[model samples]
Target: MNRDPLPPLTAFPPVPFDAPGRTSPVAGAPTLSQLGDAARAMVPYLREQARNTELERRVSQKSTDMFREAGFFKLMQPARFGGYEYGFTAFIEIISELARGCASSAWGCSLGAIHQWAVSTFPEQAQQDVWGENPYAIMCGSYAPAGKAEKVDGGYTVQGEWHWASNVDNSEWALLGVVFPPNEDGTSPGAGFVLVPRKDWRIEDNWHVVGQAGTGSKTVAIDQPVFVPAHRRLTFAEASSNNPPGASVNTNPIYRIPFLSAVPVCLASPMLGNAQGAIEVFEELCGSRVTRGAVAGGGNRLSQFFPVQSRLAEAYASVDAARLLLYRDTTEVEKMAASHTIIDVPTRIRNRRDHAFSTRLCHQAVEGLFSSVGGAGLSLDQPLQRMWRDANMMARHISLNWDAVSSMVGQYHLGLEPKGQY
Candidate 1:
């Protein structure tokens, strides 16, 4: 891809929302640390509703409302648009904190909040369309390029179905992936996402699963082609890089972060929380649980046993390591983005590799401690079982697959271009 010199970003003029001395409800523009505290505060409510959320097959409106009020949806949004304008590390930390309460809720909210960051990457007009009338409009997306669009006079006519569109039921807009027909020159056009309003399409309600059930990741279909303005479409090639078209206007350094590194970091960061949650639940249970039919002592406390002690120690170490990797890599990438230094292929590859590897560590830690939970943990009511399921399901995501990412990392080290998404 050829690079262009980015024009100096003309600052957005001060508007009513940009009052100089105004204090927000949370007091001024909330900091990332404050956002994290808010996320942590929601854990009890999220944990209490985990089962009900699964039964509904979507996150509850109350939870969504809590997140919205907590300034989570604005964490990475532009300051001119009532957002915090924080970086990737803040995003990861907030998401992980929420995941510890409920993986599905965390995943749902993460995608919704992240799309706000993504919308900031579109053309200024498109950004205005989304946030002008309503700055808090959260967006959900389906990244698979399953829809077909035909180029027209003003824009493209989009049609077809998209699957696993998480948080769609609650969102006002959607970022849907599409394949465009060939140009007049006969060369194939690039794949991209079409930003469609909720009115343009309908939900298909097909998300039925044993894990992450509350994410509401259902299929959304558009029966007939809807005319989407040119400004609404963003190509993958542009999105996967640091220099997207929206950067010309938005001009925030956080938006300059590479897509591959940014997306996987947010997607996989929740697993760290899931693992930590499982450990906490297990340790809590261990405090009260007693071993049955003990060989030496009759009905000794589970925590007193040597096996339990060793497993807890190992699991703690694994989870700690995973958290460290996520924070270290994301912070480094954020610094590079802020400094306007291009993140090289090696660093991007390492980010991808470590993300998957870290997720694997989380999965192993959760699963390893699961066996010690015994029959009590087998019940659907048990938080440990739910955490295990959530962690396992998270590991199955295409971006978090260990073998695929590891292969890409290996290939890169051998002087070959990464053969996998990176």
Candidate 2:
């Protein structure tokens, strides 16, 4: 059975349609956090292109350029490098804002921007190589265990096909995950993330999917065996313990955060954006639209119908609860990262729980919207249809699966000595 949480007691009132001081053209420029009405207004324009984006199977090159010119890619980048460095909470907030416009574009922006923060945690040499070419350089990622790495004299030889790399077409590089035999004894396989240049591999156009079609999440196959210097490979375990090589470069508190917490924020921010986008659709339909199989004046005001009202309240509450949880978790992550303290086990478990729950809430919220949507909502003009499909598709991503998260949390709570619970 689908269960929904009650709205937070201290929930902020919904954004007023006539909120004062809303600004526009959010660039010219600042981070997404500083966005005013100008930025908020652009969502409708982007939503209009949602169908086009879907048909093309990716965000348009023009849209990518628009994002770049608007400085959306640097949301999590370090300020010292002409980047935003707004931390996880602000990043989540901004991504959610963009997502209200176009979910795929929001996904791309969230993935690429969060990669900047992850890279900031790597060795300074690696960071230099990354931003050296262009301070605004964007990076897509594939952190799944799908590639192989060989221990060389200095660095490592990497070769494999990494799939589900979102926003690859607009990225300057990729951070691929690989496991290699230990150099000391070749005993245990070493797991880490390695940054690779676009020139090092070839992109395979194989990301055909039912949802998030515009993420352009293709695969990269490095047949030639690219050489990654030892500096580029960053192990999450070591990083969480303050053993990262880039510690000397960034020394900033933000770069020392735990991977389990920070990584999930990167993955979930887009969904947050997606939920906000769905809310926009819901508001429009619930206000101006009329329901079928209902009397006049009874359909336009959907609240008049008990069933419609129930679903509206249910979906809104789910979205509201999920947004609050996401904000709280991101705030905690930022605080811990600033202190350079490795998150304890309980905290990590809590984070995983929050992440899974966030996705579940958004998925259910979208489902509720679909249910409440009059038959007319099943059309291109209704962005809710797109958001609903996008939410269902992204919910399948392993990172957001509530079952897996519940399993991990359950083991921890049951004293079952779980492995990889975080």
Candidate 3:
């Protein structure tokens, strides 16, 4: 792990977690073991909604309501603000559990939760702006830095369009990337995602794609000169290192962890969850499904061939490895957060690479299951098939790209210059 000089821990004001039994459950939220059980609790309901979610091009309100009733959104938000403020490991486990039930729903919950972490990263004013209204108000964001903001007095005039705003229906706020013109007499501008009220923007209903369709990832446009109070914006440079605003207020070591880890972990955790869901499906099939003996099987597919058995083992192991990798990283984050220490750039880079690998491992595991399940896996009616397609679509996300993460991580390991855009 790369070690950066530790910044002195500062005395900050009271935060959400200070208030117990407010936002989170009495148990202080679920651990990895507990979160797995929560996911299992929803399996029947998720199976019922899986097809409906896909058919309607969005997750059903009923399914998400189940999440709400289960106190899902509060898992990541601050307790003062009605969140569990649980460790990242618990969050990942819960997300994986949700994905097993319905990948899209899990994606919504996991990706949507990032807004909670992101909020804690911004100015106290920004945090107040969000939680000051409804403590349970959850926000979802698309971190793609592809918008423009002209600097002004209070804040910048933000105007941009962003896609993949998942869980738009459930969130009242959104995070948009804006490149603001420099304050100095130079053309150099800064880039970062800014918090925008859902009311200030218009949904474009432009999310039409093959996979993860239930993500409801529509395009959002912020027209006119939108006033995004300065506090609502966090510069990428600050998040890059040395200036995370949350450390001043939140004081949690997890909150003090790297932004690189924050973003990719938010993105890939759901994918890992979804892959675990796929493994559950494969296991179910293994237990009971029969196969054609004339071609490759004897009775049930479990007794058919040793090759599939090997593939199933690989799939199981891949998921287990992915979970363990993520578990280890988040465990360290939780530990560091409690200690209130700063995680260095190289460690952040490793976390990023691990995040990317988490997705790849998920893909590989799903592929292992997909290849073995044969024709049954491709049936749209089969839940495994949905997971298969969903995993493939998720793999292509920019954050999870194989080549970039590997090259960046490898160079950092070799003591080469770090090159990362966003």
Candidate 4:
């Protein structure tokens, strides 16, 4: 673990676990543990339809309906709009549990459900515009600033093409990133995200991929420019600040955590679960697998092999370590946010470093078990093959890439400014 040189942030008071319930105006929200059980119960159904989900190139409507009915989407949403407003751990666990069933489903749920929390952190009127008519409305986002927006009277007109907007089929709104051209003073205009309704964006059916095929991560294009209200926009500078515009009205501690540092955890959580599921599937298959021999009667069980045992042990260790670190960092960050402590620069960088490292461990765990599996594991229809494909593709995400994280972390430790996006 990376150690921080700064003194502990102990001066600010810590918010009690029940603080949200006592302070929040809303009533009767379910606890985080209760929501975890709901997620765990849905695993079997998700697992049963994993292949079909990939075949259809999207999560089944049945699964989506089940998730909505179970209140999974509201885990991180604000209490005022019928959400539990739970801490980050609940969100991580919910996504991880769902990933154990299907990585693509978990990816879609994590991306879609997390947007609810993101939208809540926006201005009050923006939140109302999103959830007032329908509290359960789902949203999607593309963070790459593919559009150019002109600053107008009430808002900006945005037109951009965004790819990998996961689970767009289930979303009624989108948060698209755009870069401002320039200001009248000739200063650089920074990048910000704009909110648009589903009617303004069109989905392009272009999500065919080898791994995580069921995510429905299709392209979303805005051909005609759409006007966005200024209140609905959040700048990257605002996101990096301790006090955002929403902090004036959204008093929940859940919204206080640093976005750039904490959002990576959400992206990495599902991959960890996918790797663990791979190990579980490997163990189940290896138990009954008989080694090929000159004579059928002389064949030995694959589980008895020393190499197989070593691989299983190694994979387990890696996955367990990864999960422990994920939970540990999450709890620490949540505690800091609750206490109204400013997450210093060093701590934020450390969070980014550990998240990427954890993702690397998950990939290693999956690869170790995958390599030991026989040719039967290569079959397209095999569960092991599916896990391998999903895990491999997941490891390829920019945030999870080991090389980028290592460089950024090294630069920070050396007292040099890190270049990577937080």
Which of candidates 1 and 4 reaches a greater lDDT? 1
Q: Which residue runs of candidate 1 sit more than 4 Å off their true CA positions?
A: 1-27, 184-186, 294-298
User: How many Å off is the CA of 42 in candidate 3?
Assistant: 1.6
Count of clashes, each model = 0, 7, 5, 0
Each model's Cα RMSD: 10.7, 6.3, 9.3, 7.5
Give, for candidate 4, the lowest lDDT window spanning 10 residues.
10-19
lDDT string for model 4 (1-422, tens) is: 99879975331122223323222234677666677789889888888889999999987788888889888888778877888777666677778888988999988888878888788778889999999998999888888888888889887899879998888888899988899757779885598788899989899999999999998989999988888888888877777676777777778876877777678777788888888788778888888777675754337776877878998888878877777776667777777777888877887888888888889998888888888877758987677789888888888877878888889989988989998867
Assess candidate 4 and give its TM-score to the true structure: 0.91
The most accurate candidate by lDDT is 1
In model 4, state the lDDT of residue 2. Answer: 95
1-422 in candidate 1: lDDT tens per residue?
A: 98898986422111122111122222388755566678989999999999899889999999999999998888878877888777666777788889889999999899988898889888889999999999989988998789888889989999898998998888999999999788789987578888999998999989999888999999888999899999998887788678887888876677877778767877787898888888889989999987676467548887887878898888888887787777777777766776788977778888898899999999999988998877878988888998988888889888898987898889888988879876
lDDT of 4: 0.80
Using TM-score as the measure, which candidate wins? 4
Instruction: Go through the candidates in order and give each one's C-alpha lDDT.
Output: 0.83, 0.75, 0.74, 0.80
lDDT of 2 at 166: 91
In model 4, the Cα lDDT at residue 259 comes to 76
Tens digit of per-residue lDDT, candidate 2, span 1-422 = 98799765543354322211122222343633444343466577778888888878877888887777676676567665677555666666667777878889878878887888888888778888999768988888998768778878789999989999998888889999898666676466467789998889888999888889989999978887889998888875665664456656765555666777757776676787777677667767777775566556554566566777787677778878887787776666666655656667788788889988989998987888788766767887667888888998888888888887788889999998855637
Candidate 4 residue pairs in clash (backbone atoms < 3 Å): none
220 in model 4: Cα distance from truth in Å? 0.8
